[model samples]
Target: MSRLTVNKTYKLYIGGKFPRTESGRYYELKGKKGNLLANVSHGSRKDFRNAVVAARKSFRGWWEANAYLRGQILYRIAEILEGRAEQFEDELRAQGSTPAAARKEVLKAIDLFVHYAGWSDKFQALFSSVNPVASPHFNFSVPEPTGVVAAVAPERSGLLGLSSVIAPIIVGGNSGVVLASQSRPLCSVTLAEVINSSDLPGGVVNILTGMRDELLPHLSSHMDVNALLLCSDDPAEQKLVQGEAVENVKRVRLHPDAPLDESPYHILDFQEIKTTWHPVGV
Candidate 1:
């Protein structure tokens, strides 16, 4: 393949338009052989704050949209993935994955979408249970979106890990800000293109590629972030992030490494439990 002509411009994806990073910072993605794959922008705290605000503002509509509609949108993303499989695979390979493994990762990502799409309607029933309580009232519990979430995808397995982290949250009706994998950032930025082309909402899932250690502290402490999912391989660091989340009492999920076939329960980790009671008699 020929070299990617280094471009002179880039745009931040905020409020659906690709504008330059507010801080006017740009960084390069260096391949294992020290070649440049692409230039990704480093998001400032202000940019991160702006994205969070956008996500929070968009949360109500996304969480309230009919589950079927969300499912349809997710299904459309699957179609888009299929159409862009080669591009995604090329990105995977560009990020140090073997060609064969890149192909597998791309397929795995699509499979994840299909899996979540199937769950869009079914998970509600499975998670919601009619409680047999010791009260004279009809009682039951259901899961609801936890509002805006902040996520750090795994450092390796770029595309696959990204899809895994993203599918579950949005499928459950939550909006999120994702700190893309630092080692393999190109694919995550490219995913923004895929999302813009798919049926996903404007701010449902925002992707930012930057220095993880620098950005994660901000995400962990942000009160607007209702929940946080850290998918790093460093157990100690994961523990520290979980600790920071306790200040705001924000829900925290720590995974050193979740398998490719991780169960639906892990996806439910970022959700909130909501219960309702109604009288059956006057």
Candidate 2:
């Protein structure tokens, strides 16, 4: 008698829970050599909207959480990822990465988390400024999270590119609804599992596996989403996002070529500067 192989089902992660797409749609994930790798949920506009709702619902709590606590959670995510390094390497290899490249990407993704963790509580202070004025007044500006964010993760270098775009957004307290790479989505789903055990609040970072071409416009035009992060090299996609973003004027950030970066600016890119003034008695 032969044993039956049970396949693992990859679903969308919303509110820290895994659920199949509401539309009951699915797509086949094929490897570089035309082997069936896995089945990923083909997320729909309704699915993205549901994730956005979850994100908005969880935003206040996550935004008001202790900065140090947020940093701790991010570091914890990295710790969990490190423990699952082999798993990620295997996923990367399944997604067409060479052994050495998979190892490097997994390592880089882990370090990227820690890098943003260190900046979590510090970027605000660095971006803040005390304004100079001749009048009897105290004036200053500080950075604040931009509420719910939506992103189209890079189409290539799935693990590392996904990490590079998301760590910066969430480290600063913004909740995100990100669309993972269409072809190389295995690592993205696996990372969602890592996040679930890393002390992160539900809905803080939702991951959806689907076609970026179909989701980019919805991510842009959605009024609830306060910002958009894009990592594709497609000029048409970029133009579509920018055009749709005018509906609510979401802060849009695009990285056409290899969106990998350790800079704090990426964190600030999703933030807004709030200035205040107070009268100082002479």
Q: Please, what are the lDDT tens digits per residue for candidate 1 over residues 110-145? A: 888888887887788888889997889899899988
lDDT, residue 161, candidate 2: 86
Model 2 per-residue lDDT tens digits across residues 79-192: 999999999999999988999999999999999999999998899999999999998889999999999999888888789888888899999899999899898899888999
Those runs of model 2 whose alpha carbons end farther than 4 Å from true positions after fitting are 1-3
Q: Candidate 2 at 142: error in angstroms? A: 0.2
* Residue pairs in collision within model 1: 12-19
lDDT of 2: 0.91
Distance from true position, residue 112, model 2, in Å? 0.5
**Per-model CA lDDT versus the true structure:** 0.81, 0.91
Give the best candidate by lDDT: 2
Candidate 1 ranges beyond 4 A from true positions:
1-12, 258-262
